[model samples]
Target: MREVAAAAGVSRQTVSRVLNDHPSIRPDTRERVLAAMAELNFRPNRAARMLTTARSRTIGVLAASASSLFGPASSLDAVENAAREAGYFVTVAHVSGPEVAAVEAALDHLMAQAVEGIVVIAPQQRVQDAMAAVSLQVPSVTLHGAGLAGDDGVFVDQVEGARLATRHLLATGHRRIAHLCGPGDWSETRARRDGFLEEIAAGGEDVTGIVSREGDWTAESGAAIGAELLADPELTAIFSSNDQMALGVLHAAREAGRRVPEDLAVVGFDDIPEAAYFAPPLTTVKQDFAELGRRCVARLVERIEGVGAVGGGGGAGSATGSATDSAAAPVPPQLVVRASA
Candidate 1:
């Protein structure tokens, strides 16, 4: 700002007024400031500006996956876009494990950065608890979290989404359906499994207990579990909790000489980009993970600005969830039908 003002032959306040688009600045002065800006390639420090206004303008993001995964990656992208639109920057931290220690480590890292707000996305119980234990000195929200309720944070409707996926298969005349569920500890996996079971019971299906296989939400795990599902003669359809596992199911079925939608139908969740390019394409449940990210950031911003209620900056005694509930809208889930099913 100093350099721009000097170059433009104006006071620093004049440059500030020009940047803020103040109506009082003359056209020539505005042009000169712009010209100085161009010459210096000067970009204002948004964080520093926000600090002057008593706002950090920086949001900290914590997720379980360091590498790319469909849900986490999409959510991260959504958060980035939304934050940029809202004039904020983001710092990301990854918790590589489902344990409390991993989550605590991630939380400590985020807090150390002095971020104005935080978003902790951990789908496992231990991780959720670890995050929950974090005293809310900074505004924070949790994504896909479980074992800790109360809309105090933001989250996706995992159970409802799984119900939609399961109901879709049943609606398509698949009675002997199987589920290849992800790791049992993950709240997402548990919610989806519960939803699938609930739907089956409601529909009066036999709810073949033996038809389900446990997977690790990975292709290899899916393929391994898929083999067991294939070995069962009565199985006619399968729903894998995630696209990776669904890919395994596809590979296993192909190796076993079964044609999708002919010998057996398959559906997966997350609807990853690659899902559409699979052997016969995968019919799956799609979660707006990006929307999840946006919502989380928005909530954090609201809390940081004191414009809305969230995390009362105390222990778990405060009721931040109730105040924010009206401000929060749950993101919906959808089904994408393709050749696989």
Candidate 2:
């Protein structure tokens, strides 16, 4: 405070007021002190600051897994950025091993750190079950729509994204479309499959039952399922639950000598970075993981600030943004039509 005052040529009291964000300080004088502090890269000791104001300005993130897939990882980043901008420090714990035990350990670690709040970023049913077991010791929010079905959650509109992809297939005259769904434990997998099934039924076509195979959201798993789909002769179009799997499907199609869009088209969800450069330029639904991160932070901040969550009181809207807010929020997955589809 003294050094800032000396550098800015202001009184020590003025610098103190500026540092504390006192309303009594003149705007110009505060600006000078702040600029001087910035030039010196002066960061106030958080512990000292907290002594005066009982705020730790810290948040904890508990992730079921460290996999940076489109939803969980992206939302974690968004939450981190949001918390940082709001003047909060972040600590993250990546849970591993058995789902329930890992989550409990992660939460316990965060509790020891005394984080003001916590945000969970995993999408597994087991993760949700673990959260329920914890009873939310601190103000906590789940970024994915797991555990808190009736309560608001931050999630992408998976159902809408699936509808977009499946409707595109139907529009292209694909009647025998098959869905390569993700693991049954994920809420997104269920939502996406339901949306695809609903769209198929609404089209008034006799629904060819979804020839499904479970995957843990990996390209290898997709490839394994793709190989199986290739052996079946009647399948015309395939929508893998995610882009990684879609790429696997494309690989399998190439090996089987089937041409994309001519013999069998492919559509994938979560348009990952490399989807655009794939052999046939994968047609995929692009979801914003970064937005998920931001929402996580915002909601967590609300919990810390005692303002409650952003939407629906104590919770927020979908972490994946919404279908209608495509331009402004732009978190919903868009069908990036390409030669593959």
Candidate 3:
């Protein structure tokens, strides 16, 4: 504060007013302070400033796992940016594990700061179940939609994404298709598996020899399981639960003297940035995670500010800006066709 004030040739109080965006500060003076701040690369601590404000305007995020994972990590970045754009500060609390005690501890940490709202971005069932066991005072929402099924939840339609992948394989005439599933603990794993099964049954495909294998959402797990599933010569295609596993399956196919889209067709989920540059490229389901984040924040804000649901109520989230005024509905995923399938 002192450095910025000195650089801007203003008192510390004036600097404070600029930081707070007080209307009393003239535009030229505000510009001077901002330029000074830019030169000094100074950032005000919003949490510290919250003490003097009527509302802290902070949103808390309770993550059950490390933010390095693809799905939750991407959503976390999106949530932070969207929250900032909505004029709210974001505070994140990461749980060491999916225990009720951990969840309670994380909530307590956030509540200590008096966050106006909370977001749970981890997609694991254990995490959501643990969260459900605890009571919260502030408005809250989840991106996974695992435990919360109502209007308060926002998520990419995992089931529909799975159906898109499976339907593509089936329509391409891959009759003996196998499914590589993610670990059982995550809600997405179950939803995707259910979608694949639903499609197979709907297509009236014979379940006599079809198999579903579980992987740990890793390329190594995918490769090992892919090799095992491919051992059955009759299996002509594999729909992986995620892209990493699908990449692993590609390796397994190569080792088995099989070529993608020839000996076997492969489809994965998430359509990660690298999917398009894969060996044969990848046909996969693309989740609008950024849109999911925007919708989650919008839903939580609605509850916090009592603004009612976006687009009436219970509508699925769509891609847009100014999400607070848009629908907080479930974002749909699209199928990206590539050479893999």
Candidate 4:
């Protein structure tokens, strides 16, 4: 600022006013400041600006990816776009494990950077529980979180989504079914599995012959579990908690000499980009994960700007199992019909 003011033959205050676009600055004076800034290759100091304006204009993301899953990865990308569009920069710290120490360390890393707000996104219940024990000092949003204190959440209705898939299969007269669930620690794994069982009970289907298998949310795990489940010829359908595992089921069925929707049916969650191009396109539940991330950032900004009530701040207790109860609207899931089912 000093160099620019000196080159422009104006006071530092005049240069500051020009930088902030104050309307009172004369046109010629503004032009001179711009020319001086260009000549000196001057860049505004973000730290100094924050000191003067009390705004960092930057948010932090603490994202977890237990296995490089599609949901967390997609959310990070969407958050970057949304924050940039809202005129803020973003910093990210990834939580590679479900341990409380990992989460706390990541939080500390972000907080030390002077971020004005934070976004916490982890799919595993254990991780969310871990986050609940730590106190956050800034406004925050959680995605698929346990609704830790001082944080609002944004999520898709995972249980209803699973029910949608299961309901569709039962409505089509397929009674003997299997459920390929994700890792036991993940919140999604529990919600989706419950939905499958609930819908099956609602349809009055006998549970004796149904197959339930747990996978590590990878295609290889899916194929392994699916192969054994497919050994039973009575199992006419399978509903996977995620699309990757669904792909593995398709592979297993193919190797087992079964034609999808002809000999057996399949349904999956999270309609990833490649679902439509599978050997036989997958029928799966679609969550607008990108939109979910965008809305989360928007809501966090509201809290950061002090526009509304914040969750559990100032030592208020925490809450969990947030569905439609969060400050932000829940993103509904849609079932897309394709040849697989």
lDDT (tens digit, per residue) of candidate 2 on 1-341: 78888999989888767766789988888788889999989888887877876667788988876566765666777787788777788999888854577777887888787677777776777777776666555667667752224624567788889899999998888888888999898888888888898898887755564758788788888888988987879888999999989988988998899999799999998877788899899898887767666765666565555532333222222233433223323247677898898
For model 3, the local distance difference test gives 0.82
lDDT of 4: 0.81
Write one digit per residue (lDDT tens) for candidate 4, span 190-253.
8788878888888873642264667988899989999999999889999998999999999999
Q: For candidate 2, what is the TM-score?
A: 0.86
Candidate 2 overall Cα lDDT vs. reference? 0.77
The regions of model 2 sitting more than 4 angstroms off are 11-27, 68-70, 98-101, 146-148, 206-209, 307-331
Model 3 Cα lDDT, one tens digit per residue, 178-233: 88999888888888888888888877645422555679888899999999998989
Off by over 4 Å in 1: 2-11, 14-40, 46-54, 96-102, 146-151, 205-211, 307-324
Candidate 3, residue 4: Cα displacement in angstroms equals 9.9
**Residue 184 accuracy (lDDT) in model 4:** 86
What is the overall TM-score of model 3 with all chains considered together? Answer: 0.82
For model 2, where is the 10-residue window of minimal lDDT? 311-320
Error of 4 at 340 (Å): 0.3
lDDT by residue (tens digit), candidate 1, 226-312: 998899888988989899999999999999999988999998998888989998999988888777777777766766766324424
| Candidate 1: C-alpha lDDT | 0.77
Instruction: Give me the candidate number with maximum TM-score.
Output: 2
Question: Which whole-number lDDT from 0 to 100 does residue 21 have in model 2?
Answer: 73
